[model samples]
Target chain A: MHLLEIQNLTKIYEGKKVLDDIDLHLKKGTTLGLIGPTGCGKTTLLRIIDLLDLPSSGKIFFDGIDITASNVKDMDIRRRIGMVFQKPIVFKGTVYDNIRYGLKVRGKNEDSYETEIFKLLDSLGLAGYEERDASTLSGGETQRIALARVLITEPDLLLLDEPTANLDPLSTEKIEKLIAELSKKKHTTIIMATHNLIQGQKLSDQIAILNKKIFQMGTPEEVFLKPAHKFVAEFVGVRNVKKGTATQLEPDLTLIKLRKINIYSISHLEGLVYASIRPEDITLSKMKVISSALNEFKGNVKGIVDNGGLIEIEVDVGEDFTVHMTRKSFLDMELTVGSEVWLQFKASAVNVFECEC
Target chain B: MSEIINAFFQAINLIVSLDPEVIEITLRTMFISLSSTFFAALIAIPLASLIHFNKFRGKRSVMNVIQTLYSLPTVLVGLLVFLLISKSGPLGNLSLLFTPGGMILGQTILVIPTVIGFSIIGLRGVKEEIKELALSLGASNLQTVTTIMGEAKYALLGAIILGFGRAISEVGVALMIGGNIRGYTRVITTTMSLETQKGNVELSIALGIILLSIALIVNLILNQVQER
Candidate 1:
């Protein structure tokens, strides 16, 4: 049975629609990663699910009961869920005081959770921090403290909103590891809103890409590798995207015209379409010596940017194309701006999707 | 200059020796002003909560009027309270006129607006996110407000202290409403005004020093709570 269901949820702030027609469902003990760009109503949806805020119009069913029904008090339902905000919230007191707040609100005495608190704190690497002022802690420490407080409650449903967006890399890893462990439990259903693609793929049983509404939702590979929406394709880091007309002249091949140049892709799409190719999928060489790649372009290097691990080169054939290659390969090829180079990619590398705009 | 210097020493002597009249008047001042502040808070806090928690038609206008009342002249409130409690006035049958009870009532009326105004600001100082955080943690409506009040405790305390400072430092209400009866209704500010008019500088100086000291202590405590 679905543990949570939301139907046609909408939120408007001063008549500006923030979330429109949002529908979602999650099975029990499954982790759903909600990925979206900033200001995409991810936080708003989580807030509504946690019962912190009401949607402008929607029906929510939790545990198969209509929780959003008029005159229904959701305080009892809210207590069964835990939410950690993007920015850590520390009360005015010691670390122990901060961690004990959730239990305190639920009428649990401090003595009841003392042993459990210490064990949880020690596991989260906050040992001996019981007396330290929580407000004085670093961003990472405070975030961990926030997570610890929520985790100690043993909520059946956990809603995390970009829990590590502000932390350093090491702190981010610590938080991610803890979340990974929680996902492993398969007893606490988790819905974590984040823009980090790898974290979403690694920790989620399902991935839902959202921009005000769910654009696509499926297993990790289906959402990341075979996105059904153009926005999802572009957001998942497809750097070279161009609008073109697609024509099918072969049994399983698509030819797209990019103004002065044409490329081939292995997709069955027609009419006005947006085609995207990943920067890493294209290979660059001084001469045309491709083996099996169906699409080949000869263009001048418009610009070169030294990305830390790789070199990002923008090539201008009729349309601009971005290609990323290792620095060693770039150096060995002696590539520079204004240099003529040939790039090749398999026909399958191009992702073509029909769109109205 | 020599008289002023002598009065300064005499003021210190009176405070250190705990002069009977000075002690009596100071104690009465504390009693009346503290009672006034307590009564005002009882009304102002709930009023502030109503103004803050509700979406009313004229909320902004109501807040604007309350803020404007913060600067209401002490003498004006004194006259208003005096009329309401005087023999020919509506509450005249209660016989509260010319009594410390009347002074407390006057001061309470005088400071209600200020207490309400400052309490609103104090409550507003609590970040909107904190309230959401409290509710997110499963706090009920009343519990969420308790959390917000806890977070704004210092600012709320400061507001109350500000109300008390206004009460203890105003003479018009005490003099007009209490009648400054020598043994019954004489409080710090009214007695100071009388003694100063009579050219007894030292007694006035002693009372002024005590009043300033109370203000300083309130401020020191405020600074402590407000420290990061």
Candidate 2:
């Protein structure tokens, strides 16, 4: 059974629909990374799931109990789950007091939790800093303190809204490591919302793409490698999007026509469509090679970009298509600007969706 | 000018010598006003929280009314309390008229509006996210209220201090409600008023200095609290 379920959750803020009929489900011990742009209602959805805000129309079930029911005691359910807000919100007190606040509020004996609080502090790399004023700390320190305060609660479910948005690299690593540890516990379910695509993919077992609702949700590989729509593809870094007209072919093949080129993809989509392929999915070679990749285009590398560990080579094959590859591969192939190259990808690599051109 | 200058010198001498009557009046005034402020804050803070947390019709108008009453006439409050505790009045059987308790009652009524008005503004100034943050951490509705209240503690204390200032400095309630009885109910303001009226200008000036000093001390604390 799913540990948490949201059915048709719609939230309207001041006469505008912030979240539009979002449906989501999470099993026990699953870390679902919620990714979206700003103002996409990530915080709003978290608020509703945390039971801190009511949805305009929806039903949320936690532990097989409908939490959105009028008779349900929200505090009882909210106590079982905990949320760390996007901001590093700390009370006006010592770090010790801030970390122990959740325990104290839930009626736990403070003296008994003193050892636990210190242990949490040590794990957060904030040992010996418990005596410091929480409000006086830097942004990174405050974020760690915020995480420590919530992690100490041992909530059955956790909601983190952009947990690593504004932190430095070191603090981000620490928080990410902590979240990874929590994900492996197998007793704590986490739903973390983040705008960092790489971080979300690395830290979450499942990923949900959202705009006003759940656009697509699956394993990181499924969502990124094979997006369900144009928005999901573009958001997940599929930059080879081209509007084309597709005609259905037998044996589950769809022939699409781009400007002055014909490409075949294994999809049922026909008519005016949007076809996208991940940059890395297209193999770039110096010469035409016969292989399983049926869609081959001969073009010149118009631009070469060094992206840290990787390289992005833009090829102009009638339409400029960006291809991603390792720097080592680019160096080995001696790929440079204005170099002739052949782009090849399998028919299945092209994700075709029926949408307005 | 020479007579007023002599009175100023005499007033400084009285203040330096720490006149017993002046000290007694100052102590009595401080006790009654502080007690009234304490009791009034005990009532007004929670009342202000209730108003802030709940959505009710006419809430803005209610706040407007409270803010308007912040400068309510001291004699009007005195007359209202006088009516309640006067002989043959509703609460007359307690014989509280002309007593320190009656004076505290009148002062409390006079200053409740100040505390409530200031507290409402303070609570409103607290960020909305603080309450939501607390609630997300498993806090019940009441616990969240306390969290917000703690966030605005400085402002709330300032409210009480302002109320205490109002209670201590007002003369009409002290005079009309307590009758300014000698030694029993005489306070700084009523005694200062009486002394000035009886041509004992030097004593009144000395008491006025004491009142100014008290206000200065209160203002200093307010500055410290707000700076934090």
Candidate 3:
């Protein structure tokens, strides 16, 4: 049975619809990642699920009971769920007190969780920090403590809003590891909202691309590699999105025509469509090489940006195409502004998705 | 100038010697001011939290009026209280006129607005995220408020201390209501006013030094809490 279900949830703030007609379901002990751009109602959806804010319409069923009524006073319902905000909240006290707050509110004595608290502190790399003031800790340490505070209660559902958005790389890795462990060992269901695509793929069993509503929902591989819609393709870092009309060129190949560029894909999508290719998929070479790849064009490098170890080149071959390559490749080819290059990719590399207006 | 300098040394002597009259006046001043601040806090903190955490019609206008009353003159509050407790007034039958109780009543009225104003600011100053964090952690409604009050305890304490400072430093309310009775209702501010008027600069200076010391202590504590 699904542990939680949200049906037709809509939230209107000041008569402006923020979340419109959204539906979702989560099985027990599974992680659902909510991914979207900023101001895309991801936080609002999490707030409603955690019961911190009520939805303007629709029902949320938790454990087979509808709990979306505004006057629901069951503390037990809230007690079974934990939510961590985007900004870490550290009350005026020592680390021990902040971690013990959840238990304290439930009328549990400090002695009851002393051993467990110490174990969590040690595991979170906060040993000997029980006496340290929470306010004096670094941002990463504070976020860790906030997570510890919520997790110590053994909540059934955990809601995290960008828990590692601003942390150092080490802290982010530690938090991600802890989240995976929680779901595996404690059987805690989690819904994490993040804008980082790689992090969402790494931490979530199911990914929901949300923008005012769920645009697409599937496994990480399905959502990232085979986006079902143009919005998802664009949002998932597919840099080259071309509006074109597709014509069946063969039994297995379809030709997509842009204003001045022609591309071929293995998918037999017809009519008006969008063909998307990730930047790293398009290989740039100084010479046009004979290959089995169906799409190849000689283009001029219009712009070049050194993105740390990688080079991002915008080539104009009847159309603008952004391509990413390693610094070694760019230096070997001596690629720079106005450099002539050949762009080549396989027909399978292009994903044809219809635009959802 | 020399007289003033001499009075400064005399004021130290008075404080060190613990003169009975000075001690009595100081104790009465603390008693009245402490009572007024206590009563004001008893009413103001919860009221401020309620007004701050809830939404209602006219809430902005109500807060504006309260903020305006934060600076209402002590003498004006004293005058308003005096009329209510005077003979032929509606509350005259209580026999609180010309007594410390009357002075406390007037000071409480004067300090309540300030306490509320500061409490609202202190509570509002806490990030909105904290409250949501508390509720998300399974805190009951009362527990959420207790958590907020704990987070803002220093600011709340600062508000009470500020109210005490304002009450103990004002003379108009104490003079008009307490009648400045020598052994009955005389407090520091009223007695200081009387001594200064009588040209007994030494006693007035002693009282002034004690008052300023109290104000300094309160503000020092307030500043310390604010820094944290």
Q: TM-score for every candidate vs. truth?
A: 0.84, 0.92, 0.83
Over the true interface, candidate 2 deviates by an RMSD, in Å, of 1.0
In candidate 3, stretches whose alpha carbon ends up further than 4 angstroms from where it belongs are: A12-17, A74-76, A238-352, A355-357, B1-12, B71-76, B79-83, B86-93, B196-199
| By TM-score: ranked, best first | 2, 1, 3
Cα lDDT tens digits, model 1, A9-42, are 9999888888999989999889999999999999
* Residue ranges of candidate 1 with Cα displaced over 4 Å: A12-17, A52-57, A239-357, B1-4, B86-90, B197-201, B226-228
lDDT of 3 by residue, B1-228 (tens): 998899989988999999888899999899999999999999999898899878999999989999899888878987898899998788999888889899989999999989998988889888877888888899998899888888888888888888888898998899888899998899998888889999888899898899999999888988998887
Model 3: what is its DockQ? Answer: 0.65
Better of 1 and 3 by DockQ: 3
Candidate 1 lDDT, B1-228, residue by residue in tens: 999999999999999999999999989999999999999999998888778767899889999999999888988988998889888999998899899899999999989999899889989988888888777777888888888888878777777888988998898899889998998999888888899999999999999999999889877876786663
- Higher DockQ: candidate 1 or 2? 2
Indicate the DockQ of the complex predicted as candidate 2.
Answer: 0.69
Global lDDT of each candidate: 0.88, 0.90, 0.90
CAPRI class assigned to model 3: medium
Q: Is 1 or 2 the stronger prediction by lDDT?
A: 2
How is the predicted docking of candidate 1 categorized under the CAPRI scheme?
Answer: medium
Worst window of 10 by summed lDDT in candidate 3 chain B: B124-133
Separate DockQ for every predicted complex: 0.58, 0.69, 0.65
lDDT of 2 by residue, A1-357 (tens): 899999999999999999998999899999999999998899989988888788999899999999999899888888888888888778888999888888878999889988988888887889999999888998888888888888888888999989988889998998998899888854579999999999999999999998988889999999988788889888987898888999988778889999878888999888888888778889999998999888999999999888797898899988889999987889899987889999998899898876744
